[model samples]
Target: MTKNILISGASVAGPALAYWLHRYGFTPTVVERAPGLRGGGFAVDFRGDVHLRVLREMGILDEVRRRQTNMGNQVVVDADGGQLAKLPASFMSGDVEIERDELSRLLHERTRDHTEYLFGDSIASMTEDADGVRVCFEHGEPRTFDLVLGADGLHSNVRALAFGPESRFIRFLGYYVAGFEMPNFLGLDHTGLMYNVPGLGVNVGSAGGKTDGGFVFPSEELDYDRRDLDAQKQLVARRCAGAGWEVPRLLEAMWAAPEMYFDSISQVRMPSFQRGRVALVGDAGYGATLGGLGTGTAMVGAYVLAGELAVAHGDHRVAFPRYEERMRGYAEGCQKLAEGAGPFLAPPTRFKIWQRNQMYKALSWRRLAGVFDKMTTKAARNITLPDYRPAPRSAVPRESA
Candidate 1:
């Protein structure tokens, strides 16, 4: 039986997968390159029945709600910080919004006792045989596992080693995004402000007591080292050199800020998420960088993958294909919504920006508000979760790790 599993990434997907895998009488080891749990990511949210149901089943829904970010609707503004349109909270915050760090911590807390987490290490190579897969780590001893899963992000190390280079599967949507936190000079109270011009968009909002600064600008693909943090920041500064409103301040803070996030707003298009004994979940399989409902999707995918494995009696041949088949359509629906995120958030032309602004303004009307709220969540609610009851641990076959 395929009882031992290795999951790459300690973020939302990895830990969440570990939790479900343990509950299903499987042993899961999570490997993270970061020294420990990295924090301070933007707020992620869950919407619809599927997302909430999975969280509830995992017994974290109420805790998630307790720590939810009760942020209100965002205000779209002019170059001078004048309000243009109001973006409803439903479109931005979803049903239950929480910081990515909080969600990661919660998942880790639930699985830390049962899951083996290897920090400050990474997978260097994976060699699969008929019996099992031999895995080598960058800073640890070699080991073998029955199955390996890449729950890593868009630039997954496992995917590059097992599948192909990222270029083969990543479809760059014509834009790049960057975010960091700084002092809250704007004094925003549980609200966000958006400023845009042509193809460049900037947002500086309050998160706790700091300015949650973010940027999205249209750009063709460029060559850069993903490991070079200073170089990435410089690139963003050069691209977003001159912008109106709080952009200059945000850029300046970005240089001094301790943690910054920069990546292409791209989507992963994989023909299949499984190959031999290796499989992928979340962003590693089908992901949209920003505004993709990725967090909620990752939780649901973890539940489905682990549940399918339990139902299949720890057989990869049955579970892997079943998991992919059940999740493909739902994943595609979420990714489809992300295809236009770049253009919608940072429109190419003034006319396009005006069109987007007008659309948001229209949604603010009386009857349209309710309809718009539902429209934003339709794709998220388009899935039927399987009712999986894992066999008792004593009834399942066990393998030594």
Candidate 2:
């Protein structure tokens, strides 16, 4: 039986998978490259019945709700700082929304006691045989596990080792994004302000004296060192040069910001998520970096994978195919929602930006509220999940729920 499972990356998917695997009587080890849990990312929301069901099954729904960001509407503004249109909370925040870091911390807490976590280390290499998968770590000694999963996200190290180089799978969506946190000079509360020019957009959401900041700009895939902080700030500064309505102030804050996140808006597509006894979950298999229901999808994907393993009695040949069959279509639907995000955030021309603002302005009409709500939420409700009920006395559930 594949009782010992190794999961790479300690973010949402890894800890979450560990939680279910332990409940199903499988021992799970998680290895993360970060020294500890990361904090301060843009907000992530859970929408629809499927997302709520998974969160409820994990028994963390109440806690997640308690920590919700409660983010309000986003106001579009002109260069002179005049409000143009308002984007509703329903479109921005789902039924429940929380900061990404808050969700990560909560998931980690739930699984830390029973799951083995190897922080400050990462998978260096892997080799599979008929019995199990042998794994080596960058900082720790090599070991073998019954199965291995690449929960490690978009540019997954595990995917590199097992699948192929990243170029084959990663598709840049004609835009680059940068997010950071800074002092809330605007003194905003629960709301945010957005200002846009042709090919560029800046959004700042604040609560009290802190802000969650973001910039989306149209660009061809540009070459840059992913690890360089100052260079990233400079690139953003250059793209947004001579901009108006708090742009200079945000740029100043970006330079002084302690933590910054920058990336090309991209998606990962794969033919299959499983190869041999090794598999993938969350962003490693299917992901859109932003605007997609990525956070919710990852959590649900983790639950499905772990539950299927239990159902198949750790026989990967039986479990892996079932996992892919259930998730592929659902995953593709979510990806479709993300394809337009870049253009929506930063339109290619002045007329397009104005047209977008006007279109959303019409969405605010009371009569159209229902239509707006359904548009934002429908793609996320594309699947029906099996009710996986793990029994306390059984090592693996004898019958699937």
Candidate 3:
């Protein structure tokens, strides 16, 4: 019998999971809340060796490299936009930074041809039976699937339905982030300029990568509503109200932008990423925000989940437990990085900011640079992928519904 899997969210993890699930002879249907593909957000990176190897196996590494932003330099500026320090772009963005939407588009395009996609719809209610799960959609007919996976981001609807409230599993890193599109007013070329004021917020502007730019507002807790867009916007505006150059301008631009994203920067933590027939992949399960290992971990999770399912021959009892066992330690390591990085990202005091700058300056020493690199790479290399060969193409499932 062909196994039917319902995947929620059409972003990075959903489509990637769809790709491999389809390849492994399972039927996968993706339902996204957004009416269509969402575009325009900050760039995301894939670091370390594990994620690179997964992309190579998926036959998308060359394509992903071609789409990289190739940002030139990163400049730390003062209130007046005067450069305080200029460093090579790779230092902050990563060895390869690509626009987040472009990567989503690539993953979507790759999976759309083979998978079933239901946009502008979401699961209204879901109940699991001895045989399978019966899911009712907010906009579509009810159906039953063998399993459901939430590849949705930090604020996941599927998670809310299955696990308890998001607050129960999310650890807010005391920050609110907003991203939107606007004309490159700062005139940044293939470079980005970031200005930081102690206790205030950080505002960044870049143009070489995408037409849109955004800002980050770090706070003390995730006190705001995750769904209330207006409230989220107000929070960011209030935090950076009296802030330095380009911040006011960016806030004004955010007000008029058609598609804006605002959310608390939080990492998802669960004693177990799996619950019965429901499992979570990517940010929905363990996200460390935009700059952390969210994207890379999501990619790695997709590959591992699919491979494990294939190995178990569609037995959730075996596959799901094995999946969590294999991926949990690595997820914990990535979450730890987010905890250590939160303070540096949102320095609460001027002394902490100075200390951060001093640490950056010390990296000029080759030994210090190597130390940081190894530290980062060690976290990045946490996942140990299995050597499950692909099932024969003849096993691919045919459409039944």
Candidate 3 lDDT over 1-401, as tens digits, reads 43999999998999999999988889999999989989866777777788788888888899989988777766767778776666555466665667778888999999998899999999999999889999999999999999999998888888899998987998887766677877777777778776677765464546444655566656667566655767777777787778778878888888777777777678898888888889999999988885567888898899889877887777788788888987888887877876755466557777877777677666656777677766766777876677665555334322111
Instruction: Give the better candidate number (1 or 3) by lDDT.
Output: 1
Encode model 1's per-residue lDDT on 310-361: one tens digit a residue: 9788889988998999899999999988888888888888999899999989
Q: Arrange candidates by TM-score, highest first: which order?
A: 2, 1, 3
TM-score of each: 0.95, 0.96, 0.92
lDDT of 2 by residue, 1-401 (tens): 78999999998899999999999889999999989987666888998887888899999999998888778888999888789999887778889988887799999999999999999999988999998999999999999999999999888988889999999999889999988988888888999898998999899997534578889998878888876888988999999998888999999988888778888899999988999988888988998988889999999899889988888878889889989998999888998899999999999899999999998798778668668667657778787787666544344433222
How many angstroms is residue 253 displaced in model 1 relative to the true structure, after the best TM-score fit?
1.5
Model 2 local distance difference test score: 0.87
Give the local distance difference test score of model 1: 0.87
Candidate 2 Cα misplacement greater than 4 A, ranges: 208-210, 391-401
Task: Point out where model 3 deviates above 4 Å.
Answer: 205-212, 220-228, 364-367, 391-401
Residue 262 lDDT in candidate 3: 74
